[model samples]
Target chain A: MIQLRNALDVFTLVMLIVTIVLLIYTMSVMLMQRGKGKTPTNPKVVTKVRCVQNDYSAERDFSKGDYVGLEIGKCPKCGDTLKVEAIYAVGGPKEKDQPL
Target chain B: MDAGSSSDTWYLILLLMFAISFILNFTDIPQRIQLWRFASYIRRRLIQMDEIESDVRRRLINYLGKLNINSPKDVVDNFMNNYFLIEPVDIEPIDIIKRLSHLINVRDTNVKTYAERYMPGIQKSERYNAIVALEIASAINLVNKVLKHYFKLGLKNNNWVLLMQLALEMPNIIRIVNSYSKALDAFFSGTPIGDGAGPLLVRYLVGNSEPKRIAEDTVYYETLINGRRVYAIKAEGPGANVGKPGEAVEKLVDMLGGNVSRIVTVDAALKLEIEDTGEVAEGVGAAIGDIGPEKIGIERAATKYGIPLDAVVIKMSLEEAINTMTKEVYDGVLKAFERVKNTINSVGEGGSIIVIGVGNTVGVL
Candidate 1:
């Protein structure tokens, strides 16, 4: 019974320390990003290219994880005159065009 | 005795944690190295993209300079817009004219607009696009080669989750890159892609140059569907074109004197991971593409004319959509044809219908 109690206590202490370390690491990364004045990386950036003259347009509504490239299309604002070019993934994994 | 035992337990636990930390240090060293390597691969792709952009810009300067201009943002912009388009398949001459007409016009307008401001008497020349298209083709090839190299490196690292993620996403990554490569192939060759399927299918099935030029860059062949006079409208093909079926459909309704019975759109659709490639599905509305410009045209025209629109899709992976058309996809098209015939019959015999094929016609006869 005594040995069991000691093992449980050790586990609890180890877990608490782990939690604290993780919390601190995350906080440091966030602080560093703020210091650099860089927007945190977005994983959802998508880039679509189209000729604007044909009324063909792409929509990148800024969904939380989506990043669309060079924002030109037949949207109400971009009109059908501007063609979108490139997209930036901004530090993401396998950032490529996702078909709409 | 109890106090002594407790103290020993605390000491042992402290040592255990320190030992764990020591072990982690060794494991983390390899992971850290892998992270750096992964970063290196990403950096390489970015550099390639940058190099392509620089080369394009340089080429643009040369082209514009030949026209006696220091700068032309509109022409450059237009060039960039069309330059990025990767046509995987060949496009027809008329279809290419149809597909690129907008970009050509925009650039022409830009040139005219800019000529008024910067370099007067700058003629709108097709030669500029031809030269740039070749450059863009090489650029896409380089970029794709880099992306392939980037994804391949992921396999070397076993313990890194990020690398594993990249490996898993490799198929999709290659899919997009392949799309660009194929688009380049189509653009440089001036051939309409298989995505021009709608137009090509109509042309192929219609089997003649006699297809009536119905709309701007659109055409139709008259046939009977279920004993009803069916007018099949698609973009005119034998070239790279997504013929404006939207406008063609509208024209059909006008020719029929309004109150068309039904509209059936046949095109390729993307299949999910769970679905089989080359599968056939029947649904409502535009099964055309993600962009709604064409869909909107069809839907509005259908709604306005009070017609029931049906979409028959030949299932294909996005990879297949951008890559060359596979036998399976072609077979699916054959199957889709049967469905189209059935759809016409089911909608009602002796009723006028319009069948529109939607997709890029890269390698379909």
Candidate 2:
């Protein structure tokens, strides 16, 4: 009976350690994720990008469709360089009710 | 090591397990909420199938009725309800439909069932709609089953790690759901998902009327750019579909006697968070999906021929890509069009260049 009790204590200690480690790992992950918006683990970010369009051009009123997003780059009509004139918080933070 | 301390350690173990369970279960609330949304959306679609009139329903009825599927909803519901048990639900159902249709059609070929059963002059569009109804039903079924699975798992809360992992992946899962929703919308509208972008750009660049049907569901036109010929290709648009642009590019390459110096492919790409919609990104290689074989074929052909391949991508949310072409995404079309031209321009006055506007050419003519 004494030996059995000792074995149980050892088992309980091992489980406690495992559980504590798992909890710490989980907490750290959650804290890390809190810093950045929940990006996918695979990320899928294109590092091979030769060119990126960062132009937050003025949010123009389109007669059709709600302004959900902006396609920045070369002007579709003309190949002239297109860039965002000002950031409008269109999609990123503060976009919930931010006016154009 | 004593019995008393062992009992205390057991208590500690129990407390830790309880804490871990609490956190894991708490973290899963967001995913459960998404599942609820998915459930409601799928329920709406299943209900809509009954009332929404005209040919799509009729086609579904006729197609399934012939299959002796008298109560289509029951089959769909059964499939939806029992979907979790359907080992390996990761494969997108719509992708299977095309292959399944081809296989089924081939198997039933000896009897000429399609021609014999349908009324005279039943348009291909009707048949396509029938297939779409089935695909949408399958997609809805998958989501329904998954939503239920998550609901049950949430209730159990036994597998905290599994639940947490799912919680992390919830965004992508929701992203796919949004895309499938758009595809469903496109099906009902009988218009392709933002098809006009690629083809319109192709047309603007080519600046020509005569579009040659070079491959199955693909079209190509040509224009002289700085004393060199540039071949523009896109799926035949203004129809309810994104044509096989990859195959079309291959066909164009072959038709040009394999002397094509450069190939530029343009398509819509899903944007990440903070990446504004309609953003154009220029890069290298193919930028289309759902046509894996075609992408491979093009890549293989390009490699064999030693032709440099460049890609111009119009970035938008998967929601935008699957849904009707929003003004923002459409705006990207012209930008992408311009980018395509620029891509061709940077390639230098080409001996012969192939510019493939790679996307579903659904609306913009």
Q: Which candidate ranks first by DockQ, i.e. highest?
A: 2
Estimate, for each residue in B1-365, the C-alpha lDDT of model 1 and write its tens digit. 76677777778979998988887786677676776676566556546555555555555455556556555445455444343443322345445434554554464455345335554554222232233343444455465566556555654554366564654555465446545544443333333333443544454345332578877556688876447767787654333345577767777787788757888888877787667766888889876783434676788788887888888877766645654344455566667777777777776667777888776432222
State each model's CA lDDT, in order.
0.56, 0.57
DockQ of 2: 0.04
Q: Least lDDT summed over 10 consecutive residues: which range in candidate 2 chain B? A: B81-90
Question: Distance (Å) between predicted and true CA of B260, model 2?
Answer: 1.2
* After superposition, candidate 2 runs with Cα above 4 Å error: A1-100, B1-130, B149-157, B163-179, B347-350
For candidate 2, write residues B259-303 as lDDT tens digits: 987888777887877788789898888877653556765786688
Scoring only chain A, what TM-score does candidate 1 earn? Answer: 0.36
Question: Lowest-lDDT window of 10 residues in candidate 1 chain B?
Answer: B123-132
